[model samples]
Target: MSSLLVTGGAGFIGSNFVRHVLATTDHNVTVLDAITYAGNAASLDGLPEDRFRLVVGSVCDADLVNDLVADHDVTVHFAAESHNDNSLNDPSPFIQTNLVGTYELLQAVRRHDKRYHHISTDEVYSDLELDDPAKFTENTPYNPSSPYSSTKAGSDLLVRAWVRSFGVQATISNCSNNYGPYQHVEKFIPRQITGLIDGVRPKLYGAGENVRDWIHVDDHNSAVLRIIDDGVIGETYLIGADGEMNNKSVIELILELMDQPTDAYDHVNDRPGHDMRYAIDATRLRTELGWTPTYRDFRSGLAATIDWYRANEDWWRPMKAATEAKYAKTGQ
Candidate 1:
């Protein structure tokens, strides 16, 4: 099996991907993350050293990226600044990691023999008409609204160019919101769960009407393995959970799982330019890769997630405390 190097393997999705790779397969895995406040090193706590190694480094470091590329056969890029709330205030980190970091890393890959896989978000398709209802496809128009998504969209374009111009064997996966265990507490799902668990009323932004399709991290990881092993080169795959829900409904579901009433939340002003809805047509992924979500409904997956948070307070309390410090420093 070829060696796999996963960037940002300490963060939420990246860390879950690493865990999936280590637990399910015998392939050698290497994780390179800068260990930002959001990137907690403990995510990869107990994997065998023979099967996994974690390197603390930024993706922007060209030498480091090249060294890892030289060592690994496939590179999955997931190291972008992901929080929408933080991206609004200072978009520089997002620009640096998403745009500049991608440029540097792709340049390195162009000099080597490897496949580069980029994990991107659904926010790239922002200009969807309020009334015009069409799920975003791989060929969806690039109309990103916020800084975080704009940079992610930019990085995806750069990957396209590298494949077109540099002959890099590359593929991209644009996915919907993901909720699962060990996710940083800043995201909506984990934030709501952790806050409610802590006996605090969770805050909802702008009446919580924004619609999103959410996929479990494990299902997302399963689709990723399919993309790496079987997806066509120079193609983009949309991996969705076949689930659609609004923000308010998601909160209510979490409340239900936690056995709390629906009135447990406090509404707050919506962030500027918040997209009202986002949905993706993942039929191509299903058709081309023969991939479908194992958990077609949110009930069991979310119930398990809530149970994990409930059972693992030791794991989440420190994370919640660390996020509070980061938020304080950034005034988020």
Candidate 2:
């Protein structure tokens, strides 16, 4: 069986991807995570121990990354300082983790001549105007607005350069916003969902007009696997399920699904440098690689997500107080 090393495999999307890979394939997996506040080891519970292991370390640790890369047949990089608000608070960590950590991985994989895949966000393309009829494609130019997205954009460029300069076997996938089980409560969807569960009024940023193209975490991971199996080296793919909804609508849906009045939410100050809208065009991934998202209906997908947060309170409860307090300080 092929051995895959997953960086940030304990975090939200990374944990979900790790689970997806284990459930669907016979490959052996090693998770390298920093165990930061956003990374929860419990998310990885119940996996087959024989085929899975967790290594606690920073991806920026060159020695650790090199050793791990040398041993694994493939490296799927999902590690990064991904919270936009946290990046706004301090861009230093984002730079250190996203850019420098990616550099370390690229160098290691280059040395080992192993296959690699980079997980990125569609925010690297900045945002489209709310009224614009355009969606971000693989060809979209890098114009990231926030420190979080800027660092991811930088990381993506690093992979491309490594592929050209050193011929590293790496491909990148830029996915839209992901929501499902194991997501930290600090995120938008889970924040609202858990708040309603706690009888706290859900907070909406500004008038909540900012649009985000959502995708189920599983769908995103499935596409990632498809790319790792068949994608051309040095190529980039955009992943989306065409699940675009404004922040206002998303909050309303969460309230509705949670048996609360849709108008029971409160409006809050919007974060600085908030992108107006983000949409992804996944034509290349679908037509070229023959991959399509399973979660076609956003409403049903969101309802299921709400159900997850409700049923798995232990997974998200500890972080709820701290996360809400952080947002309250900034009134977001």
Candidate 3:
């Protein structure tokens, strides 16, 4: 069995991945997390202590990274400053974590000759027009629109360069929007879900026409495991489940499911540089790696997510007030 180091393992997607690995494989996992506002230690609670350990630290720490890299057989790099709104307010942290942090991870993996996989987002390809039928593929050109996306794009390029020049055994995957349990309230889905829980109107941005290709966090993690096992090095895969929905429709569905009025939500000013749409084409990953997403029904997945938030008030209550307060300043 492989020993794995998972950076950002306490955050939303990372924590889900860690659980997936433990449940499905015999790999012993080491989680390296900075416990940023988005990183919740409680997410890792009840995990098997003998096979799982959480290291509280930044990915930008080269010495720490090197030490960890030497012990693990593989490194799954997931640490990043990932919120678009936060990046717009201040780009410095995104630059440090997404760019510099990735560089340090690359160097450490290169030093140890360990296999590596880089987790990234579809935002790196920028956005598509609402009427456009095209979706992001492995060959999409880079055209990031926000500081957050730009830094992620930069990190992807860094991995590519390391694979070619330094011969670092690495692969990259750019996934579409993810929604599931343990997500921070700052994200779109969880933000709206929690707002409704607090008796606040769910807020929509612009005309609420922006589209996102939704994928369950479990599906994304499953694909990551497939790649780790069988995917060729130096290749890029796009992970998606073909679940696409517009903002307004999603809010309406949530309200309907929650037994609130369909029009119970509010329209707020959209964030600056908000992308119009993001869709992913995962044909390559499917045909090559034989990976298929289990959560295909968007409404079912979303309903389950809402139920999770409804039942787990204590897990998200501490961050609710501050997240809403930050959004209040911008009237979003």
- Give the whole-model CA lDDT for all candidates, comma-separated: 0.88, 0.94, 0.95
Candidate 1, 1-332: lDDT as tens digits: 77999999998999999999888887898999999978888778888898899999999999999999888988999899988878998999999999988888798778886888999999998845546678899888899999999999999999999999989999999999998888888888888898888887777788787888889999999999899999999999998987778889989988888889987787777788999888889999999899999888898999988888888787678868777676557433
TM-score of predicted structure 3: 0.99
Runs of candidate 3 with Cα error greater than 4 angstroms are: none
Candidate 3 colliding pairs: none
Cα-based TM-score, every candidate: 0.96, 0.99, 0.99
User: Which wins on TM-score, candidate 1 or candidate 3?
Assistant: 3
What TM-score does candidate 1 reach? Answer: 0.96
- Model 2 pairs in collision: none
Query: At residue 94, what lDDT does model 1 achieve?
Result: 95
How many residue pairs clash (N, CA or C atoms closer than 3 angstroms) in each of the candidate models, in the order given?
A: 0, 0, 0
* True-structure lDDT of candidate 3: 0.95
RMSD of 1: 1.7
